[model samples]
Target: MRELLRSAVAAGACALLAGALAPATAFADPTVTIEGYSTDVRAEAVSALVAERGLGTASAEALLRTQEAATSALDAALAQLGDSAAGGYLDESGAPVVNVVNESAATSVEGVTTRLVTRTTAELESARDELEALPQVSHTAIAVDPVTNQVVVTVGEAVIGAAGTAGLLAAAERMGDTVRIEHVAGGFEPAIYGGEAITGGGSRCSAGFNVNSGGQDYIVDAGHCTAAVSQWNVGPSVDASFPGDDYGLIRNDTGSAPGAVSLYDGSVQEIASASDAHVGQSICKSGSTTGLTCGTVEATNVTVNYPQGAVHELVQTSASAGSGDSGGALFAGSVGLGITSGMGEDSSFFQPLTEALGAYGVRLN
Candidate 1:
């Protein structure tokens, strides 16, 4: 009886041990958790690593997976988890829009009570100016996750298009890449236009509009416009319109300013109200073909080569802007901002409102 009892007890112990040794289901789902001061902090960290560590997309992705693994391990060890590391997962849109909150906090998780931020390719513009000031890094391209303050940095060839590549390299060199300084090959081009109304029948050219700066409203147009083409009026009675660029400025001998760039359906967006069009702002344009399409700004200060000559310092975006959108008003919530100019088929690009304001010497009021 004693031996049987002993054997039974031993079997029970073995069963308990086996159950303990079984794999936990917690790691079955791949989850990413980020902890930091803000989304921008994590994003900037990731961007800087991409530029400095000579990491590629695959490597970066792998790092994300590793981060998940670390979170799982940490979760297993913690008595209570805090805010699930304050992050969201990537969805079908290649974006992390859904956030998981309401997580409980415990003493073990208290150290990681920070926010995780994500970023996309669009936020690259904001980082451009900062990264440009660096030296060891020759170029840097920053794209932001439109939903969050997350920023991604792609160094060298990894930088999308010319502007992005330049942005990353410039930033990396500033930090000084002594280990792996891979040279970027080939040149990159910026997108032409982010909005469109122009059709096949309309002639294709770039255009710009007037802008306000330092209390002066100035005539702003595409650089491609001929200097000889000057005489112009404000309303209707117009002879020849310039489509050489997306937006153009009309010289008013009588001092009458044009009302605004109007869409074919009669929707009008004021152009003078734009002080500075931000990086992620949604913009609409009126052009010859599609008429009044809208999209977001991807980047700015991108230089591209037009068939005529190399046009430098252009705006870039992922908005599906096409012909006729050029010379059209780019509006943010009915506020006039950027002018439609051109597209490179991949992305839409524009000129800055500041330059437009500088040319006219008038206030946008």
Candidate 2:
């Protein structure tokens, strides 16, 4: 693959996240297309990896090749193999690595290799379900970390005053060592305030990715934003969900929803599809208040315990975000990764774009 066109690895890549409009033309079901050499996506991916993960420029470029190849191997394995197929990850060497529960499953994908785990991906998910049974500990979060091969539970000051902290500890203990607990500082909170993305319901939130549902254009954001206020900049918030999930969609009454995301540098990245954030992957976020920032995805399928309630399937990252960033865009290159849901100093959380799009029956325009 051609090395990324001049590596713009500086933090300058991030800017105020601006929402994109999906084209009015017919849309197709979004598919995973591993980036190829010399492609625009390859450069973006390289730039993101270097900027966010602190990978050396040459190392980042090489790793992209490995990542793409691993993705290809994963697709073939899932298609040729059966349900035993779990998922894959990128190793320290930037080689695509696959994981499987069944020993008989394909152990290697082209140039990549695989690792064996005792539990199937489904079984691991079942293990992760134990978090739902635990008491709600404020300022706490849980996520499935493939890198650690376990569910990680994070706690902070939010639990000090609550009895739920003990309850959480007991639950984690019962779940065994597969549940990893770590303490962090500060509490997770939504980054919405008096700024404007579209105003209604007495507050404002940054807009997420633009999507098309039932042939109409709409913008998505954190469900809490929708719950607080129904009036949106483009139109009224027609749908929203919180606690169980954190996603909301607003009707785009305006014409021409472009399928692009603002780069904060007078340029924009064309969004092709909504994708789930993977651990170790570089991600960029844009909000009206914070403008733009980049970071590495630390975990996925995280459950965040908010003061109001629990929001499931959130993605955690090291990105810096603040007030007015909620519902902002979390993306990788042109692929929509997640919607900025909430954050703390060390880490921020987001609603996975794939789940949000699926839940709302919408696709990126």
Candidate 3:
């Protein structure tokens, strides 16, 4: 666990880091109304898009609207296509792209572009499962790539020349083209410590979302963080799941848990609902170490082998996060998506909010 508040020195360091990472627009108003949407969008979220994608404010807002609409269409197509639906994602232009094994089923998916793929999602997932069952390889991540119709395996530089790497490579080779191996620069580890948002047991982590279960309020966060810290500044850890999954719940004893995410600015984004992440969807995350950052979703149902243990069903994103960012909120507009888990050299991983909510029998407050 990355504890920070136990010692004055650690607390001071966290404060300084938070100050350094705080955005210049922290004092500005948080919400803005975008055309064609019923709810207001967070101003800080728009700024994050402008910074990361080099898009104008209006364009960023429009892109968000497009992605939201696409998400709805994706849900409908997935429900209709069922077994025929291989996978779906947003395109660079923010249009939904649905992959289907049966070309006939693709015809039924309207309002979205559809492509014919050789393998179904189940097949790709099976391949991913086989790789995960292998001897745990540190610094490695695996996910199903529907666009390529294959299981993509990413190995970090730390284990590039190790014996385990050689063995893993051999195993992948035997699996043939079903698995695609790619090497990256750094290893994946849980991002913990030196955070400002929430503190407990000398460790620090950002809150994911405010939830309600059986009339009791709770704050959800990364399991690894809660598992290490039993007591939090906001509440106490009541339930946690890690290794196999990364999610936890802390009772909101303070009676002030809001269904909003800090923009790292003075204002916060009000999250009205939660949704599953789709690859290629534009998203943002807020953390004590990096403030608010925006990027595109790269993959979902990802499996990462960390030094502590293997975490499954994580959503991978191109968003940037750093130490002290663990358990931060990952969202698109007002819709919650995931809880920050860890990162590799070029990618960050998050525990899906939907799964976490299911596991805890909670709903957004």
Please tell me which predicted candidate would have the highest TM-score against the true structure.
3
Greater TM-score among 2 and 3 belongs to 3
Provide the clashing-pair count of each candidate structure. 88, 11, 3
Best by lDDT: 3
User: How should the candidates be ordered by TM-score, best one leading?
Assistant: 3, 2, 1
For all predicted structures, in order, the TM-scores are 0.41, 0.80, 0.87
What local distance difference test score does each model get? Answer: 0.37, 0.67, 0.77
Off by over 4 Å in 2: 1-54, 65-69, 75-87, 106-111, 118-123, 194-198
- lDDT for 130 (candidate 1): 56
lDDT of 2 by residue, 37-59 (tens): 21333444555566566777577
Q: lDDT for model 3, on a 0 to 1 scale?
A: 0.77
